[model samples]
Target: MFSHIILGARDLAALAAFYDPVLAALGLQRMPDEDDGGPAGVGWQLPGQRLPQFFVQLPFNGQPASAGNGTQVSFLAASREQVDAAWAAALAAGGVDEGAPGVRPRYAADYYGAYCRDPEGNKLCVVCWG
Candidate 1:
């Protein structure tokens, strides 16, 4: 249903560095040839699973990037182990922890997930729905 998501990042390089490994751990790869020039950010997408793309870039209107309250972008994982790996990768890349890897019973019985904020303060969630 969604074509793509582009989160504003004051520092595009920092956001990309922070997310590179996190996305890789979930089997997503950055599109190296995806530079659109003005205020464009890096893009990542699942191999063979196109349409939905994730990007980090400066605000198109030249506004400073700010984290929105209660706003988050969640990435789906393939396994519980991937969730754990992604959480660790995020931390290693300077992300702050919002939640550790484990079953979020409130979301579902098998909703294993981890939550964190990117270097730019954008909220993120990685989950594996069993």
Candidate 2:
């Protein structure tokens, strides 16, 4: 339902470092740099697909980037293992844990998810629904 989701970042390189491995765990690959022409940022999408991209970039308004309260970006994971891998990768890449990987029955019986804040403080969730 999204053409793209862009998170404003103060440092593009640092944000890329955190997202690269985390998205890779969820089966996303970085889009070619040549495709990201509008802003100084990096984008990721499912391999061979063009839409539904996720990007981290410097603010377009020439202001400092700030995380929005009560805002989050969630990615789908293929399995519980992928959720774990993504969460582990996030933490290892300087993300802060919001919730550890586990079954979240409140969402669904087989909902497994992990939550974290990116290095730029953008909240993210990786979830698997079995």
Local distance difference test values of all predictions, in order: 0.90, 0.92
Off by over 4 Å in 1: 35-38
Task: Specify the poorest-scoring 10-residue window by lDDT in model 2.
Answer: 32-41
lDDT of 1 by residue, 1-130 (tens): 6899989988888888988999999889998765567777888998888878988888989989999899999998899999999999999999999999999899899899999998888899999999
TM values, all candidates = 0.93, 0.95
lDDT of 2 by residue, 1-130 (tens): 8899999999999899889999999889998886445668888999888889998988889899999999999998999999999999999999999999999999999899999999988999999899
User: What clash count goes with each model?
Assistant: 0, 0
Best by lDDT: 2
Q: What is the alpha-carbon lDDT for the whole of candidate 2?
A: 0.92
TM-score of 2: 0.95
